[model samples]
Target chain A: MRQIKLKERPDGMPSAKTFQYENVDVPSRNRDEVLLKTLYLSVDPYMRGRMSTGPSYAAPFKVGEPLNGGIVAQVMESETEELKEGDIVTGALPWQEYIVADPNQLRRPEVHGAPVSSALGVLGMPGLTAYFGMYHIGEPKEGETVVVSAAAGAVGSIAGQLAKKRGARVVGIVGSQSKGDYIVNKLGFDEAVNYKEENVSEALKTKCPDGIDVYFENVGGEISDAVWPLLNTFARVPLCGAIAAYNLSAGESDIGLRVQMPFIKSRVKMQGFIVGDFSEHFREAYEVLSPLVKNGELHFEETIHEGFDKVPDAFLGLFSGENVGKQLVKVVEPEQ
Target chain B: MRQIKLKERPDGMPSAKTFQYENVDVPSRNRDEVLLKTLYLSVDPYMRGRMSTGPSYAAPFKVGEPLNGGIVAQVMESETEELKEGDIVTGALPWQEYIVADPNQLRRPEVHGAPVSSALGVLGMPGLTAYFGMYHIGEPKEGETVVVSAAAGAVGSIAGQLAKKRGARVVGIVGSQSKGDYIVNKLGFDEAVNYKEENVSEALKTKCPDGIDVYFENVGGEISDAVWPLLNTFARVPLCGAIAAYNLSAGESDIGLRVQMPFIKSRVKMQGFIVGDFSEHFREAYEVLSPLVKNGELHFEETIHEGFDKVPDAFLGLFSGENVGKQLVKVVEPEQ
Candidate 1:
């Protein structure tokens, strides 16, 4: 079994040097454990937060231990009656090609005859994060303008789509023209502003004719600077992520006190949240998001990298804005 | 009758040149308007936002118009059946010596036989602001540490007291040592950090032994910088005022984007609100706060700038941190 390890923590924009590749013998299943062979691995922006030693929603990665995140694997051997051999399960697990997981910790997500890779992207943590942030936090009213930063990425795309489902005029902020087209045309967003192409502030003013009422803030930085002044009175901002600050030098500001005045002046309610904080509502999120995803009412995309060795590249590409949607690695093919 | 008019839109802070005092003939009361003799007028941090041009909860003051705010006035003549002559009423009224007021626009606050000026201080806008922000927004639980900025000022003092009433260990951040002493010694706050004298962040780390669960943010500058990182998981911030940012040059960032990472990592909730936004529940706020004032359960202080002409100076002194409590201009004494 092959796994990835954190060799060194990067100061900014993690590179290949931060990771170490290792090989280990596939372990046998224990009484409560299910021996699994990895089928797909998910690399996420939040993993960057786990790299540094600081206060965070999740614990930081131990330097010599195997780095782990969302994984979809097929059960190779099972001692528990809950899961059987050939059954596929998904959850936060180690980055190894094969590993043992407790049956209770993994979920057998119903893919509704869809591809198993969907479990790591559209039907997994990314999907749940978007769903909870949109419905429970953003709470967009019909016909109100809803803006989402990181609009081409996993959570942002789904959040914007769900906002549209709730009858909001959804405008997306993306890094490239192609991604803008993908969100606007393919994902059914009302508008998409290419942040690299045009001045986002002026573009937002034009697109969101009615000032933004709910801002699903994922990539906070200049995008936030543009959205701040345009927020309508009593706007609600579900602060989900700040990918822009993940690579900043220590002591540097991300979306800092700049928001304080705007928040005060407009009576804005900005709530920061992690998906785990809303774990009690995960079943509800799946019930709501699964149907739309299955019925093609909610569109999702993914940028796939082949092989387990490509995991570090997938994570590094996130900072450089390489992926259009959920970035995942195809570790190995699942048996039909 | 004399009134204060906004002379010009200020570039940063309003000076004597931005204000014009006008003398007008005292007019007879209209059938629906009661003739009012202003007794006390409030000068608040929020009024500074009204001085500039931008998107604010309250409309910006139009140049050449009378500057108005929460006022305690004596009815000189009854034009409607709603009010009688000599009745002390409170409302948002012009900063004028004598003016006409609509019965519907004024409130007859219950002061429990306390001074009428209490309507503009402890029992009026500032009091209600602190009351609602603390209860509805901060929602500090018993034994949790609650920190308030601008702690000796009108809103902060009342907020800290209410937090204490809720059984939270209350800590205050004040701009001066004397104000710090006033809050800790007289008001019975658990601790007070003099921001101007000591390292605020370190002071907060020491004073708030359990970390902060609720932060009543009124100043929003260095005080916020100190308060942000100390916020515990799921900490609630009732963003009531930004007095520190009231006089910054246009486009200058005050309390800018430095809070983003801390806010996100801690899953904090920072909600901004004007007192008037809770106007529907004003009666409830008064109901809850009035008895406390009457029973001496809620201690309050006021810095009285005597005479109607002192209203401008009183308003300006707020930016300089000159007041210990609610700053009010005593325009005239109530009728005997």
Candidate 2:
């Protein structure tokens, strides 16, 4: 078996050297446990927070420990009736090729007709994130303008589509022209602004002539500064992530325009949240999102890298806008 | 009649030059109109927004136009049966000694047994601001920690008291020692941090050892910077005013520590609002607050300027933290 561990905490931007690959023997399973082989692993921008020693929603990943996150695996052998051998399951697991896991810790992904890897993206945490944030916080009304930053990414793509479904005039802000084109053409966003090419503020002003009623904030900093001034009265901002500030060096404050004056003038509501906050209502979310995925009404994209060795690069690529959508690593071929 | 007009838009902070005192003829009343004698007029921090020719919740005060705000007055003459000649009333009106108004624009304050001047402080717009912003937005739970900035000012004072009444541990951040004493000793706050005397961030950490669950944001800038880092998960911030940045010069951005990362990490919800946003529910707020004031359970302070000529000074005193509780200008005695 093979495993990857955190070699050292990065000072700012992480590098390939931050992860250390190790060879280990597969551990035996106990009663009610299953021996599983890793199939796919998810690499998310939020994992950057867990890598740091600072306080966050989730506990920091311990130094010199195997990095763990959402993983899809196939049960090679099962000792319990809950799951059978060759059954596919998904849950949070260690970065190992083959390992022992309790059957209770994982569940069969309800992917419907979508790819099994969709369990790591649209049918999983990212899907639920978009569902809760857009519906519960953003609450885009019909004909209202909704702006989504990092629109081609896992969460934003789904969120923008959801807003469009709600009859909102959805405008996406992306880092590249291709991502912008993809969101507008394939994802059905009303408009797209490439922050890297166009002046986000001016472009947004032109596209969202009535002002933004809902701002789905993902990549913060300059992008957010551009969105603040254009928010309409009673605008709702669902602060999902700040990937732009994830790699700031120690003591470097994430400085930008103040939100007080604009917020007060517009009577805007900005709320920061994570997907787990709405775990109790996840069934409600899946009931809605699963059908959309199955019916091909909800579109999603995945940028998958081959082999477990590519996981670090896949994760680091998130900050540089290298991935069009969900970034994942395929560990091995499933035996099911 | 005497009126004060906006002489010119102030580049930054307004001075005596910003106001023009003029003599004008008293206008005649029409059908459903009343001639009111201004008794007391409010000088609020939010008025600074109106003074600028910029987009705000309320329309900007046009150059050469008389500034208008919440005023307490007595009807000298009436053409409708809705109000009598001696009836006391309060409404948003011009900064004039005597003016003609439609009865539809004014309402008699239900002051219970409190003074008529209380109509402009604890029973008027400021009071409603604290009521909604505290109850609807802050929603501080028992034993939770609530921090209020500009604690001695009108909105902050009332908001802090409201949090205390909710059985939360209340900590107030004030500019002066006297203001701090007023919030802590007089207003029943658990502790007060004098931003001018002590390190605000450090003092808050000491006082709110459990972490801040609700923050009543009255002043922005450094005071807000201190509160963000100390907020607990699911904390709520009711942003009512930002006096600290009201006088910011043109093209000067109101810069501070970025809120994105902190807000996301803590899942904080910050909402900016005015009293009018909750106008439909003003009766509900009054039902709860009027008795608190009449029973003396809700203590209030006033820094009343004696003459109409003192209005500009009274309004400017808000930015300098010279006044405690509500600041009002007494124009004249009621001509009943």
Candidate 3:
């Protein structure tokens, strides 16, 4: 079995030297445990926060420990009644070729016609994150202008599509022209902005003449600075991530804009949220999002790496704005 | 009659030139109007937003128009039976010596035992702002650390006291040592940080080892930057004001950290609110706050200026950090 471990904690931007590779034999399952062969490993931006020693909702990975993330695996051996051999399952598995997991920690796959890897991206945590965040916190209304950053990425792509489906005038902000074109032309967004080239705040105002009523915040920093002033009264900002400054380690950056004061003037409601905080809403989110996916109302893209050895390289790409859509790694080929 | 008008919109910080004092005859009272003599003029941080031509939640003051603000007034002539001559009232009144007001625009003194100026400060908009912001948004729990910026100002002072009243550990962030001592020694705060002399972020970590659970944000520039990283899981930030950045006309200052990822990492909930948004909860808030003021459970301080002509100077003092506690301009002498 192959495993990836954290070699050192990164100070600012992480490089390939931050992780180490190891070869080990697959461990046997104990009573109530299921040994599974990993199929797909999820790579997300939130992992950057975990790389730091700062205070966060989730604990950071200790140096030399194998990194763990959401994974889709095929049950190889089951010593539990809840799962049978050959069953496809999902669990928080380490970056390894195989894993021994508690059956309680694993959920049986209900993919139906969708690919198993979909559980790691659009149909899984990222999807539920967009669903709950946009619905519960953002509370996007019909005919309102909905703005989203990282609009062609895993969660953002789905969020923008979902907002468009809800009859909002969806304007997406992306890092590259390719991503921007994808969201506007392919995903049917009303407008798209390449934040790298175009001015986010001005573009939003031009496209959304009525002003942005809902902003699904994926990238924080200059994009937020641009979007803040354009937000209309009673606007809702569902802050999910801030990939822009995740690499900086000189404590927090000091971009002083007096940003929060807009809340009082415009009465804008901006809420920061984590996917794990609203786990109870997972099923509810899936029930609502699944039909949209099958009916082609919601579509997603994945940038998949070939093997477990590539996991570190894929994760490092997150900070450089390299990956398109959800970044993921293929651990082992699925059993027929 | 005397009136204060906006001579010109301020480019950055407001000054005496921004205001113009004029003398005029008082208008005759109409059927629903009551001729009012100004008692107290409330000068608040929010007024800064109104003086600019830039878009804010409230409409900007048109050049050459009288500046309007919350005031405690006395009914001199009542064409409406709702108010009688000699009755003290509070409502939105322009900066003036005497004016005719509609009866529906005013509310009688709700707390007879406490000073009426408290209506504009601790027991009024700023008080209610602190009340709902702390209870409704911040949601302080016992043993949790609640940190408030602008610790000695109108909204934050009351917010810290309210948190302490609820059995929470309250730490205040202030601009000066005297203000810090006032919050800690007089107001019963567990600790205080004078940002001018101390390393705010480092001091905050030492004072709040467990991390901040509730942040009452009043002054938003460097102080907010210091407190952002130390936020604990499920932390609540009630954005009240941005006095520090209110003077900046445009262009972002480098503060070092951006909030995107930190807010998400902590699952922090930052909400912006104006007291008027919760007008429905005004009575509920007043019921709790009034007794606290009357019974001495809650203490308040005011920097009183004598006369309506000083209103402009007092209002401008907000940006300079000149006034202590709730800043008010006394327009009338005490009457029995």
lDDT (Cα, tens digit) per residue for candidate 1, span B252-331: 76445334322333344545433334446544533433343345432233455665334335533433334432344433
Shift of residue A228 alpha carbon in model 3, Å = 1.0
Q: Candidates sorted by lDDT, descending order?
A: 2, 1, 3
Candidate 2, A109-165: lDDT as tens digits: 766555466566655666566666676677889999999987777677777877887
Please identify which of the two predictions, 2 or 3, would achieve the higher lDDT against the true structure.
Answer: 2
Regions of model 1 farther than 4 Å from truth: A251-336, B255-336
What's the lDDT for all of these models? 0.66, 0.67, 0.64
Q: TM-score of chain B only, all predictions?
A: 0.75, 0.76, 0.75
Off-target runs (Cα >4 Å) in candidate 2 are A257-336, B257-336
- Lowest lDDT sum, 10 consecutive residues, model 3 chain A, at A261-270
DockQ of each: 0.06, 0.07, 0.06
TM-scores, each model vs. reference: 0.76, 0.77, 0.73
Best by TM-score: 2
DockQ sort, best first: 2, 1, 3
Number of the candidate with higher TM-score, 1 or 3: 1
The TM-score of candidate 3 is: 0.73
**Model 3, range A72-163, lDDT digits (tens) per residue?**
77877877789988888887778777799998888864443455665555455565566656665677778989998777666777677667
Q: If both were scored by lDDT, which would come out higher, candidate 1 or candidate 2?
A: 2
Question: Please, what are the lDDT tens digits per residue for candidate 1 over residues A120-143?
Answer: 554555655666667666788999
- In model 3, what lDDT does residue A147 have? 91
